[model samples]
Target chain A: MGQQALCYDGTWKGLLSLIFDVYAYKYSISAIVTENNAIQSLLFTSALIHVVTEDIKSARVTKGIITSVGKKGYLELYHVFLSEKEGRELLILRTVQYYLGVKEQASKNYAHADVLEVKKIVKSVSRERHRMKAFIRFQLLKDGVYFAIAEPDFNVLPLISKHFKDRYADQKWIIYDVKRKYGLFYDGGEVQEIEFGTENRLDQKSISLAGHESEILYSTLWNQYFKSVNIRERKNLKLHIQHVPKRYWKYLNEKIEMGG
Target chain B: MGSRIQEKLSILADAAKYDVSCSSSGSDRKNKDKGLGNTGAGICHTYTEDGRCVSLLKILLTNHCIFDCAYCVSRRSNDVKRAAFTVQEVVDLTINFYRRNYIEGLFLSSGIFQNADFTMERLVRIAKKLRKEHNFNGYIHLKTIPGASEELIFEAGLYADRLSINLEIPTEAGLKLLAPEKNHREMIHPIKYISNRILQTKEEKKIIKSTPKFAPAGQSTQMIIGAAKESDLQIVHAAQYFYTHYKMKRVYYSGYVPISNDLRLPAIGTEVPLVRENRLYQTDWLLRFYGFEADEIVNDMNPLLDLDIDPKLSWALRNMDRFPVDVNRAPYEMILRIPGVGVRSAKKILAARNFEKLRLEHLQKLGIAMNKAKYFISCHGYIQRYADQQSERIKHFILSGSSSKYVKAVSTQLNLF
Candidate 1:
């Protein structure tokens, strides 16, 4: 039973390093939480222990996971971690500890609650990742860089970065997560994470000030195309709203009412 | 948007909305040259008011037609504002929309303005310019104009990702009754030619390293449902013909939306309930993925689909002798036939059962709908009691159990597409 809690930095590598220390230090943790979550962990249990993050420890745990569960299984664990769902760290740490002990592909054992939850959480995260890719609406700025703002449900920027980089290899673009306050900038050659801080977060007016002369024309044309393709006979607002939910409509070019 | 180009776009897009082959999958085109976009699984950029996927910039070259088909909105006799986009306009629109991630790619269809050859050449020219001039590698679905010269249609396969020629009506008699000028013979020729050419190109590529790709996403076609007095069995037979003969990626069954008051077609204001269109799609899925044949879904005896339940449930209800399948021992094919077990759940059952015997709890964990599947399957923890009941009693039990108000509302929505 994990009565005493172990805390580390809120990073994937930090979790892995904690798993490394779990065996080295021989500390039985009742719960695995981030130091960022340490203040709230006291509500459940008063005892909180903070551990240092070490690169060598995390690297060893990473190799062990890949060797035991394979590449796809490792990514599933990473997505479950990234999902930051309630009690996710404890669920993964326990399942992985059990999987490392067994030779069979125990991570895929749906009979166990931990294995099933990992799959379910990964599926939801992957769905959100796909929705982000489909719903990203970019604007052509005056500086010749395409810019878009996304507010996804999960921390999916790391997941979708490769898809955008490979598909839009020629263009310079930035996809900034407004909620996360961090953005990814791909300048035709490299992808770099950039931050605007809380106060300097970018807005539409400032973004549009640097927009190209042809930007308005293209967005307006997109809005027009969005309206024209609908068949009136098959109109079902319930289904339409289900496919493209109201939450994503704020950034969609067609959903935004056109100003005449 | 400017008035002139915007006007043409609305006119052409409004004209081309009915041809619903909006899938952007099957193309292995990579953006290797650092061009614009690439194709993978289809992505719906947004949905229309009718809930159809707005994946492609689906528009026409022009809305002015030479032939008058009673089911068509762009018929020569119809009174509408006709407009057309020039070659450059189509190319520019596709590029801009693609760069902004507004659409997957272009779906350029057209009404025959002059002759079939003249119109097809213009459509091909647009595809060529997008590929060679702009290096646009996104999914391009070109409409293969019927009766166009064989060489011209072949050229379209070289540049476009998918090619289609609509059968319009499912059966020959339906085509004759709806449009006397059109015949199944002329429409089927180009599809057959393209199919042969695709196979021939694949054969060449196996030996020669430099052979170019031809319609890498394969082909698809759409048929208007409920237009002619054809039975559902005829529609399923026609769809099976396309899939088996051509190895088609899809055969879209679009419900007949009455646009005109033609005596041969459904009159205006008669709504084609989405339920019928949705049922045909379910039957299509059963045939293609569930190892079920065309005759099994519909036959001379049961020509029409049951409007109350799905085709799979209807088939299961009629053949109740095959119930109470042992999930722990039954094959994947058998598990797929169970009412609530989907393709994904069936695969998961086979995978998870390799480690341990799958029980009712494991099946529920794998996301199988236990409500209906519980009656058909017996696992370690649960045994079916309803399998011994009469067909009518079981049907009524399942139907009433699923008639929650939320389920009733969502069932009306066409989420199957």
Candidate 2:
């Protein structure tokens, strides 16, 4: 039983500083905390240190590891940190710190268990990235802005912007990841990040123009098309929901008006 | 006619809605200048309640017909709302819908407005206007009127990305009894004619190097199953003939939906045999992609597809002597016979195995669902004996699992919408 190790803040720079501390102390760090813990570790001793603020030199050194090992290395360390896999994270951190000391030896194909583990984490992240592409649903907002909300397991918001930008070039849209509290907004051109506090919870009734004349016509025409195209004999309700999950039914124009 | 057009479209599009091959695929034509829209691989704007993609502006040119085809809602004696679109109206609709990004292009069919030639000419006029007047480069699928004049059929081939003529029933006798106006020769003649035109166009393109694309997405046809007494074997035979002789892109089998208590058609209460439709599609894939022939899969003696098992697994079960193909050493085609290995998964196995000798562990890592594939394939030196030993029992086991999987997929899909 011992007190949990603490770091200054929960930024990328703070995590790197913790890695540096582990290397300097020659002792594997269990965890880094921004706050105190009630339970203490009995078998292993813990060290608490205020995280050093990121400077030009430290930033340059961390950027070098990322640039050399590529984005996969950085993401592996991030996922392990998020999962709070103490032993795995410590091993990865120590390996990265050692590799940084010998930059030429830090090839992506390096024969190390830590490197392979990082590849697994990278694979998982990429799978999550593809899932977000498939599952993200866009709701047409009142001001003609199509907004979508997702809560992907990983930070995939930045990766999916290119797809929407190319596909919906004529429209303005926003895809927000509520879990990460971040969003990507496309304003008929390039995509940009809209900060967390800038937007509020979307009001469904306010966004819908059902009461307006033109909106009613558009909805009626769409429903006409929807109803016309449905094959009653082949009404496999199961297959319909698979392609378009009911979770997205709230935002779909045809579904919303018809109460499908 | 405009009011009539709306009424018929609602009825005919509702009828044509079940045909899943409304896809505008296989041709890659972009709008050259400031044309209304471009055609890419099947751009689905939305999915209907049945989860089918709605990409094409699927509609009939005219639903008024002289023929009394029992399976069709637009049959002459059905007493349904009748309508026909003017050439200009179809052109306007295509342009407007394309501009709005609501559809990729038009899938135009007719129900014999006057005769085959007359109806075919009207369809040709619509395509001509869309291409010549508007310079529209989007996908156009024109249903060839079976007995249309050769000249009119040729004109349709010039403008359409794909041309189709439905073999509404599987057997000649069925066509004779149910649809007296539609004979075997009438239906097969246009398919043969279009196939020859397509081949001739390809030859012309080779010689002059500037012939226009002729049915560039290739000719596809539909067969209405369960409307006749003909077995799956007969349907597969006709499909094979179309594929080999006509060089068809696809033969879509639509399960019959009995609309009325017509004596010529089946009872209305019976289900459309969706499971049979699913099995046919799987077998169709085998024919196209897996180098399987209709005769090899099933024959006249083995007329009906086993309702319980998928066509592929049924084929594998019958030929159990070809079981336990060595995954590590067998050729890609041989590995394809293993029930669970899809075309994509088989290709993945081939690619990944080249990097290393694949064991059960390696196959698992390569994303092969071992439970299904393991029964049919051997990894390294290990072969699964259970599937071969209790082949009948294994067939039932696998089929039940597949049925449940489909059920779950359907449930999950329903929950989504």
Candidate 3:
């Protein structure tokens, strides 16, 4: 007859379990919905809704993807989930279908529609990861810990923690993603994930609470150095904006005086 | 911007901007538990308005000089304000700027003061204090003063990651004309001294465990382009000699920016040959990475590069009798000759084609710039109908994208660095 509709809890594991149900019940799924997205409960429809998030089923599906496409492909699947694109769940499900249906290796066959869609999302996430490495500048706090706040367009904190952890091993630092309401803290030993309480949003006062007295002195020196190094004989604002866009001004200490 | 340190930074930084080598790569140093910084794959924290990469605290120890070079802004005859930083001031500025993530490390050069040995001694002391006293482990690129003693040159290499001595003019005749005080032998002496020590240490490190690294990033040098009447072939020959003989890591080409109105130099308002500078860089890349020789790019017949097309595309158009190679079966070297296929895509095509024959659509998905590569290659499903077309028509087709409006807009004006 027709395909059935399934609702999940909108997690990576929850989506994997839904995939397991698709094979177990031998019924094609028309759509997948999370709880936040209210689905209409219409009458006289061939729909089977369930909250089936079995740990065993999710683990099996993850193992199958790893065995088929190697470790790099597995990471691309995770990146697809972390993306903020709408209807990414269904797009990921279709990619899994294309991977299993083909006889030859499908991930290398970029001509496939499902593979192309997933690679596009992976490219976007990796671009954000590179920009984070280039644009994230830390400020010295009063407690000797360097702190900075960034609101990247993608969820890239997990992807960029190792870079800072290796480079700044002798100091303590915290990179708080204000938009995601979480932070990554490296306290001279190891990295840990932290979260602020629900009531307090990161504001101006909270950002400078741990500021040392000499922080302003160093910042002004940096601003002066930034202006001094610029060769006015060949000034091109177009190229400068291309590398450091306007959206990332707040995170950069030197660009703050430019007033965006 | 009017503080004492700010004043010195402006003067010193402006004096040092003409040296177009700001790279912090070629050395991989890890941070010790007590240190505050480490080096990675050359992070450019910021780009100047000229689009040049700024990875290090590029500044001079002092602007006081004893010699007068006609093209130099910091020549002794020029009436610019004089400034100098103390040894402690440079160490502190580097540490603080590095701690705040403003730069990767320090690039300290200076105008000759009193004598070559005296000036070299001061530069070595600043690097020594940073390494031994402060326990810093970041990238340090020091400019080696000509005629310094062998003992001091060896000591500087022990602390610095990379050392360089600029060959400002390509030929000895050009050097004699523009820079009266400098000769080719004095400049090449330090480069050879540093290169021999680097080789000697490589052998020592293999046997002894605690030998201590010496200039692990190797050495690089820069030559000013368009400052004199040297041909492109002459410049490429000089670069090839450096790469083959000196084992140079890189050769940077700086388009000469006019500064003075001396009869020996161009007028102050003369335009910088930026396009020729870019073409020379492309030719240098071919020598270092693309398995092309110096004579293959510019010969006696073609003494200069065609400023309209890049060096690689120019090579391909001249040798079009070797076109229409099968992408599904061509070797990796041949695949690299295609106009749009870079090093990355060439490797990808080699790996992907073993499983199945590739098509035009598959090539597009693999990130090939098809608009340019379509005229030179064939696949399982597609071949260029214009493969036998005249070279001029094919060149126009390839360059039509830029010839429409993009090249016209930037032809007269200087492009980004």
**Tens-digit lDDT string for candidate 1 (B286-403):** 9888999989889998998877788888888888899889988998899999988899988888878888888887888799988778878898878788888898887888888887
Which consecutive 10 residues in model 3 chain B have the weakest lDDT in total? B408-417
Q: Write the per-residue lDDT of candidate 2 for residues B1-417, one digit (tens) a residue.
A: 334445655766765565557778788766655444456546665577777777788888777888888888878888777666678877876765554345668999888876889889999989988988888888999999888999998888888899988887878888888888878997888888888888988899999977888888888988887777777888888888888988999999887877878976778876676667778898899999999989888886687786656778788877888877888789989988787788866876776565456777666655566667777887775767775467788866665655454554444323311
Candidate 1: DockQ? 0.77
- Model 1's CAPRI class is medium
Runs in model 2 deviating more than 4 A are: A1-215, A258-260, B1-9, B34-36, B86-102, B131-136, B206-210, B387-390, B396-417
For residues A103-136, write the lDDT of model 2, one tens digit per residue: 5435343234465456566666666665555445
TM per candidate comes to 0.96, 0.73, 0.90
**lDDT (C-alpha, whole model) for all candidates:** 0.87, 0.70, 0.82
- In model 1, what is the error at residue A101, expressed in angstroms? 2.5
Sliding window of 10 residues with minimal summed lDDT for model 2 chain A: A36-45
Q: Backbone clash tally for model 1?
A: 5
lDDT of 1 at B380: 86
Off by over 4 Å in 3: A1-29, A32-68, A93-107, A198-210, A258-260, B404-406, B409-417
After the best TM-score superposition of candidate 1, give how far the Cα of residue B216 lies from its true spot, in angstroms.
0.8
**In each prediction, how many residue pairs overlap at the backbone (N, C-alpha, C within less than 3 A)?**
5, 10, 0
lDDT of 3 by residue, B1-417 (tens): 227877897799889888889889888878776576677558888777677777889989999999898778889999998899989989988987787677889999999899999999999999999988888888899999888898998999999999999998989999999888998899998899888889889899899968988888899899988777788999999999999998999899988888888877766767677678888998998899888898888999887887787888888888888898799998888998888888878887886786678999889988998878898999997866877898789889888754433265347634421
